[model samples]
Target chain A: MTDNSAHGLEAREDEWLAVRCQLGERAAFDELVARWHEPLWRYVRRVTAEDEAAREVLQDVWVRVIRGIVRLREGSKLRPWLFGIARRALMDRLRERYATPAAVPLQDFDLAADQDTSALEEDLASMQQGLEELPVTEREVLTLFYLRELSLAEVAEVLGVPAGTVKSRLFRARQMLRRDMDTKGRPV
Target chain B: MNQTNPAHPGGSPTLPDVQRLLDAELSLRSRLGYVALLLGSLGMAALAGALWLTEPALPFRTQVAFALMIVIGLSWTVFSVWVLRHRRVLYARQHIVAGRMAVAFTSVFVVSALAIGYGSGKDGAYAAAALGGVMLIGAVLMLLRGHRAFNRLAERRDGLARELGRST
Candidate 1:
């Protein structure tokens, strides 16, 4: 099947699950938790870099999802909407930790245009250890993109940013990961 | 990569653990309880306000007491509504159930008030019956809206299931 058709099928399946949950099907909520828990856990675990924090944040994310799903008009957009709630939950936790209003500035990167692309061509799997050292903004974009967790458009929707901004953040994140690896005397 | 941490013996919350955490929020009892609270409070407030307005020779202290009862009832009504809307939200099926409850409660209220009004020959009871009638109409409208919304969602759900080769 073409990518578009595959995506369409996936969207329909997601919508089906969402509609079932909206209809107050107990089994559907179990299915939802079974299906998406690991992916969401990984995302939160990576971002928080703490097992305890990820557990707390993931629970909070599910709470928000359960309470807010009825308000979600377009069920086909469940993937992005779920991630968006996770993002907001993560930000709230981070804000509480740092006692700051703005957790991460989501500004467009002019510096991303100047980063070298040669080192980024290497497999990102080799640089997993370096991901923890990068800033949240860069690490987030890289995690969402490189982990194959979400498509570019889905990532943009989750971040509430333009597709171009997502691309720039990915570029900057890759370069930062490479530089971090190099400084630690690790092979790129 | 192994997502588990050996250091934290119980690394992450398992699926069961997560489900358990969400159980309170998804409790049907809690949702229904809030719905009952909302309807009961509204009914109390409406009756109290109607009596307060219709009784002409009520003492000043009696008027103050009625005003307090109305305020307290309305406060509970607002609290129940907020809890239902935000904390323990009513899903489509729950909405239908709540709507039916509202209709049933209001119908009983209207019937009781009308009987009391005709039997006692009191204007206050008549005023209360009028309020109950208004509530009954609102409840019927709410129930109709809920049914329409549920059917729309169910239709889309069945269509998607068919397209995806799954049972509805």
Candidate 2:
């Protein structure tokens, strides 16, 4: 319950910042960028699996948000809206780079830190490998649901699908990941 | 959740460069260009609205105004549809649905106007009716296409719901 309240408070703060951004406050935009830049980039990178493409998509997404901020009527929806933009930008980049809407190939990420304990590294490697084997659509749904911690409705919004769609995709994704992890004798 | 943190040990190789990203947005020229495009679109829309409202009864002037309005209004509509399609944002489904309904309504209006013009008089009758017919056909075609797209989205939504053991 306390965690929920804290999250609500954080959302409210983001809403205030969004209102300031709508009113053309540069500092408000900067604050928003500082808060969301990392998370947004991570989401894009996971979707596209290409660092350079993700960077380009991130740049384009911000350009769009800056241009269209005034059109955003509900500041409370700022987080989902930003994720939605990142999703669209990533899709556009992928569509342009590939003639067909091909499933994204998961690029290698260096999940091991030299200073980290061995057990954590093994968990990270297993998780990453499990994620890499899933289809792109399932992978995307899982990433948004588990990694981003977005609700079904929020994931639907980011993916431009109904909440029902998100729910099913998430279920299937979890099933697939669990099966894969179990086959490898690793905990999901 | 810590994975989202910029300083997280599992951070992706392409870590978010917030300063560099902010720097990209600080260009005065690009901002000015955006403002200019917005202002220009608004101006054109307003002008089109005014011309449509004050449409003169004189045949030639009315014809000229109608032509201009069609050019400006339809151009704007086409541009809007293009942008919405290309952007494919989260709320695009809502906008596209609304746009299709609007187009459908406009088609009915065009056909009615043609009927009324025919009943009123023969002066400028053929030309006006011809143009109206063309517009009505175009609008109906667009509406049909929009409906198909909307239906596909709806079906996908329903199918997903069914898969999740929910009836839609």
- lDDT for B79 (candidate 1): 100
Query: CAPRI verdict on model 2?
Result: incorrect
Model 1 agreement with the true structure over B70-136: per-residue lDDT tens digits: 9999999999999998999989999999999999999999999999989999999989999999999
lDDT of 2 at B134: 60
Question: TM-score for every candidate vs. truth?
Answer: 0.92, 0.51
* Highest-DockQ candidate: 1
> Residue pairs in steric clash, candidate 2?
none
Give the per-residue Cα lDDT of candidate 1 at A22: 93
Give the share of true interchain contacts found in each model.
0.70, 0.05
Q: Across residues B1-168, which tens digit of lDDT does each residue of candidate 2 receive? A: 112335534443332454455555544444434333333443344344444444446587766775686577557656655544343221323434444554554455456555765787543443444554564465567556656655654554455445444444
Give each model's whole-structure lDDT: 0.85, 0.59
Assess candidate 1 and give its lDDT.
0.85
Model 1 chain A: ten consecutive residues of lowest lDDT: A117-126
Cand. 2 TM to true fold: 0.51
